[model samples]
Target chain A: MNLYLGVDIGSVSSNFILLDQNGRLYRKLYLRTLGNPVKALKDGYASISDGLDKQHGKIRAVGSTGSGRHLAAVLLGADVVKNEITAHAVAASHLFPGAKTIIEIGGQDSKIIILRNNIVHDFAMNTVCAAGTGSFLDQQSARLNIPIQEFGDYAVKSGHPVRIAGRCGVFAESDMIHKQQMGFPVEDIIMGLCEALVRNYLNNVGKGKKIEEPVVFQGGVAANRGLAKAFEKILGLKINVPAHYEVMGAIGAAILAREQMELSHSPTRFRGDNFVLEGNFTSNSHECSGCPNLCEVVCIKRDNEVLAYWGDRCKKWESSIKQPRDRLKVV
Target chain B: MSRVGIPRSLFYYYYYPLWKSFFADLGAEILTSAPSNRHTVERGIELAVDETCFPIKVYLGHVAELCREELDYIFVPRLVSVEARSYICPKFMGLPDMVRALIKETPPLIDITVDLSCDEKCFQKDIIRVGRLFTRQARKIQLAYQHGCEELRLCRSLASQGFTMEEAIKMWEGEPMEAESETDLNIGVLGHGYSLYDERISMNLVKRLRAMNCKVLLPEHLGSEVVEAEAATVPKRVFWTLGRKMLGSALHMSQREDVDGIIYLACFGCGPDSLIGEIIERKVRDNKPFILLTVDEHSGEAGIITRLEAFCDMLRRRRNYRSESKLSPYGASLHSFENTV
Candidate 1:
C-alpha cells in the first residue's frame, strides 16, 4: 500500500495529492497560498497527513510542480520537480485517456496544450500578460460585490452577455466599467466578462493551435462553471472537467513520482510527516555586491541549518553550499 | 598613441575582431566597454529613447560607459549595409547620430559609415579615412584592413566549430575556453548575436541549456552558404541582415537530423523580430518543436525557466517515446500512465 505524494505550489493555490500503488487518487487537499507558499505547503501537508491510519500505507516518493515548484522541492525533498505545463498535460491525458487538448487557466497564467495520441504535441503559455486568469476573475468578483464562488451562478443567469474588450486586463476593466455605467444587467456583464476572457485566452494562448476534442479543462479556474460554459460555446466542443480539476497538477505530479520510483527503484525522498510538521523554516535575501550584477541571492534555512541558496547569476552564492541535494536543477 | 573606445554591444559581437585588429595594426589602443551588467542596462534604459530595441538601448549604455573613460575617440560606426541588397537594422544606421544626441561631453567619434550595399569602394575609402587618424601610411592602412578581414575570417571559422560568436571572439582574443562535453540533447538556439550572446540580455540562455545537459547549436555553427540557400527558399528576400541569417539558420536547423528542437529568442519591441519570428514559426517544418521566447525589460527569470523546462521535457519525452516504437512510429502501444506507473 505504498503511496506517492504530489504537491503543486502555485501563485494562488497550493494543492496536494496522494496516489496509491495502482495509480488511483487516495487523498487530495487544496489551500490558498495567500502570498506565503511556505505556510501554505506546510498547512496543506499537515491536513493531508492528519487522520490517516497505518492501513493507508507509508509515502514512497514525492513530486512537485507549478511556479513555486523549486521552493516546494527544497522544502519537501521532492523526488521530481516538474513544470506546470508538463504536470497539467500528464494529469489531463491520464484522467481523459483521449484528451487531445488541455486549457489550463490558473491564478496568474493560462496555457493551451495540444496532445496527439496522448503525447503533448504542442503547447503555449500566456506571454507577459495575465489578462484572463483566476486573479482577474477574483478582482472583478470583488469589484462587482459578488463572492467568487457564486460568480458562475451569476454568469449563467444572463440573457445576453455584453461585449467587453479582453485583449488586455486594463482595457477589459475599463470596458467592464463602461458597460456597467451603461446600465447593463449585472449578470449579463459578468457573463460578458467571462466570454471576453475566453476570447483573450483563445486569441493569445491558443493562437495557431488546433484544439480538437475531447478537450479537458483543469486548473483552479475550471471550478468556474461560467468560464467552462464559455469555452464550450467558443470552441463548440464538449469540455470535460475532471472531478478533481483543482488538484490535477498535484495528481500529475503524484503519477510522475510513482513512475520515477518504479523506474529508479530508489528509496522515498519524502522527509516524512514529522519533518514537515516540526521543521521551522525561514528565508532571507541579500544583494550580493561582489560584482556589477548585484544579484539578490536568497538563502533558505530550517532553524539554524542552511538548506539552500539561489538567485546569483555566477553561482557564487549557490555553489558555496556543500549540500548536493539543495542544488537547483531546472528539470 | 591614439585611444579608441568601442562599446561592447550590437555590432561589437559580430565585427569586434575585425575592428580590434584594424585599430591595433594602425597603432591605436583599443578599449572596449565592459560586458553588460545591471548598471549598463539601467543607464542605457535611462539614456535611450523609449521606442528603440533592447540591444540599441544596451549599446547606448555601453557608449555612456565609454564616455566615462578619458579616451581620445570612440568608434560608433554608422552601419547601413554589409552585403549587397541586404541592410542592417535602421537603428544601426542611425546609432551614431543617436549616441551624439543622447550623450554630451563625449570624446571625438570616428563615426565611419560602412555601406557595402551597392559597392565596396566607398566603404574602403571610409576605412582608410579612419585609419588616417592613427597613421598617414596609405599602404599601412590597406594592409591593416586586410589583416582585419583575415582576423574576421578566423573568428567566423572558430565560431563554426561549435562556439558562440562571443566565445569565438574570446578565443580569437587568445582566451582559453574549454570544449563543451557531449550531451544527450542537441538544441538549436537562434537569435541576433548582440541580444543572444550578451549573457545579461539573454539571461545566460546558452549556459543554462548546457548546464541542463544540452548541446546548443547556434546559427554561427552553420556555414553562410547553407544558411543563405535555406533562406533563399522564401518567396521574398529578407532585407534585414540579421533577420535573414535567423530565417536561414532556423530553416536549416529544422531539416537537420541531429537537431532536436529550435528556440528563438526575440525582444518584445524589436521591429525585425516581430516579423521574423512569425515567419520562422510558420516556415519551420517537420513538426519540429519550436518555441519563440520573447524577452524585454520586465522579463522574469521564473517565466523563462518554466518555459525552458517544459520545452526540454517535451523533447525528452518525445524522443524516448519515439525510440521505444521504432517500427510503428505512431503506435498506440505506449499508454503514458501505464508506462509511467
Candidate 2:
C-alpha cells in the first residue's frame, strides 16, 4: 500500500496522521508538544512505526502544518506546508462536505471558519485573549482535582449549570473560586465553565460572522462532549465531530499533499521511516549582524550538512541555500 | 539658527515635506525623530495611556524621543480638518496637550490649529502663523510658503503616482528611481499612511505582498477626488480624514473588477479603525475577499505569515480556477467531500 504522512506541531500539542492512497486512515498519534517539537516529532514517528508491522506500506508523500510547520517541513522533507486554518478547513470539508461553519477550539487557540460550497469564505482567530481554549479548561480541571478527560462527564452530570464569568481568564478563575466557596456542586461549576467558554467563543471568535447550518467542530477540545452540547444548545444547531477529531489538521495536510502531488505529477519526497530513526539532526541559530534588522537566522543540519535556514526577514540566508533553484535532496 | 524637531508619526507622512521645506526656507535646522522600532514601541507603551491605540502610543514615543534630543521648538500642530464636515481623530486634535501631559520639561511647541474646513486661506494663514515664530518679514514668509506648497504638490504627485513615502522622499533628494514591475495580482492595501508605510509597525506588509507577486495599491495612490467621490456613496460619511480615505478607497476598489481583493491593516485598539474597518468589511464582504489584519506590538510574525500565506493560496487557487473555466460565467465547481457523519 502507498501511504502519506502529515504532522501538525502546535504550541500545546503535536498530532500525526498516516493515510493510505485511498484516503483511509492507517495510524494516528497525538502527543503534548511540551516546548520541544523536535523531540515530540521523533517520539511520534517512533510510536507510529511501532504500531505498523515490519512489512508496512511505502510512504509516498508528507505534509506539515501549525505554528511549527516550517521547522517540521524542513525536518521531515514535507512536500506541502499549510497553515492551521487551511488544514482545519480542508479536513472539515472532507469530513462534512456540507459544513458551512467550523468551530475549532484547540489547546491554546480557538478559531471560527465560515465556508461556502467547500471554499473558506471567512475566518477569525482568538487574539490577545485565552478566555476560550482547551488550556484554560486544563488549568481549571487541574485546580478542581478532576482528570481533563472527565471534565465533560462532570458537566454532563450537572443538574443545573450555574453562571460563571468568562470574559477573561483571571475573572473566570476568581469567579469559579467564588462559586466554589459558595458551595456549588463540582459538576455544576464545570458545566457553567463550559457554557461560559462557549459563550465567549461565540461572542469573540464568532463575532459578526454568519453561523450557517451543518456546523463541524473539531480539535482537541472536540473531545469534550460538554462543550459540544453547549455549542449545540447556544447555536440551536446540531454539531458534527469527526472520529479523528484530534488529528484533523494532520489529515487535512495529508489531503493537501495528495492534491499537490497529483497536480504536479511529481514523486514524493518522503525520507522514509528510517530517516527519523537513524538520522542525526542538529540545529543552531545566530543573529545576523549584516543589517539593523538583526534577524535571528536558524538552520537545520542533517549528517553534518546544512539542509535549510529560515527566520531571516530578508531571505538572505534562505536564498543562499537554494541559489540555483535545485530540488531539496536528503543526504 | 534654532533647531525644530518633528515627531515622525501620524500626519507626518502626509505633510512632512511641506513642513520640512517650510522650516528649511525659514533658515531653521530640521530634525525628525527616528523611524519606529521595538525600542520606540516599548518606550511608547511605558509612557502612553493604557487605553490609547498602538499608533498613538508610538507617536508618544516619538515625541518623547524628540524631547530627549532637546530641540528648540517641537512642531505639534492641532489638525482639525482638511475638508468641511470631516474631522481628524480627537487624538490628533489633542496631540499637543497629550504630549504636554506625558512629558515634563518639554521644549516650546509650535502648536497651531489648522482648520482648513473654513477655506484654503486658512492653510496659508496657519503656515504664516508658524513662519512668524522664525522670522517677521512678510515677503520671506510668503516666499517660504510658496516654496513649501510647490514641494508639497510634487510630493503629493509622486505619492499618488504609486511611489511610497520613503521612495518619494528619496526621489525628492535626487535619488535614482527604481523601476516598478507589473504583477499578476492587484491588491488594494487600505490603512493609515503611518501604519501602512512603517515597516516595523506593520511587519513589512507591503513588501511581503510584493514578494508574493502582488501589485499593491495604497489609499494615497488613489487621488483624493476619487476617494471623496466613493466616500459620498456611503449612507453616513466617515468623519475622520484617514478613515474616510481608507473606506472610500476600499469602496472604490470593491467596485473595480481588476482589484482582486482588499486588505485593511489596522493598529490594535484604534477607535476610528474599529468603526471604519467594520463599515469597509460590510461594504466589501460580499463583493470581494476582504482580509482585516490587526497588528500590535505583541503580534508574532509566525502567526501573521501563516494567515497571509493561507490567504494568498486561496486567492491564487480562486484566480487559477476562474481562468481555467473561462467558458463558464461563475467558473467550474470545486469538489465537496461527502458528509460521512
TM-score of 2: 0.91
TM-score of chain A of each: 0.97, 0.94
Over 4 Å off in model 2, which ranges?
A51-55, A272-275, A278-287, A299-307, A323-331, B66-71, B104-107, B119-126, B176-182, B320-341
Best by DockQ: 1
Residue pairs clashing in model 2 are none
Task: Score residue B191 of candidate 1 by CA lDDT.
Answer: 91
Find the 10 residues in a row with the least total lDDT in model 2 chain B.
B325-334
Candidate 2 local Cα displacement, residue B109, angstroms: 3.4
Q: Please state every model's RMSD to the true fold in angstroms.
A: 2.6, 3.6
- How much lDDT does candidate 2 score? 0.81
Q: How accurate locally is residue B136 in candidate 1, as Cα lDDT from 0 to 100?
A: 91
- Candidate topping TM-score: 1
Mark the regions of model 1 whose C-alpha exceeds 4 Å error after superposition: A325-329, B325-341
Model 2, span A1-331: residue lDDT tens:
7777889998888999888877778889999999888888888888866746546776778888888887788777787778888889888877788799999989888998888766677788886687869888889889999998999998989889999988998898999999999999989988898899999998888878999989999999998989998898889999888899999999888887766666557777667667776777788999887765566788888778888888788889998885223333110
lDDT of 1 at B268: 82
- Worst 10 contiguous positions by lDDT, candidate 1 chain A: A322-331
lDDT of 1 by residue, A1-331 (tens): 7887899999999999988877778889989999999999899988887776678678888899999997888888888788888888888877788889999999998999988877777889998789889999999989989999999999989999999889999999999999999999999998898999999999989888888999999999998899999999988999998899999999888877776766667676678877778999999999999988888889999889887898999988888877545222546
Give the Å shift of residue A15 in candidate 1: 1.2
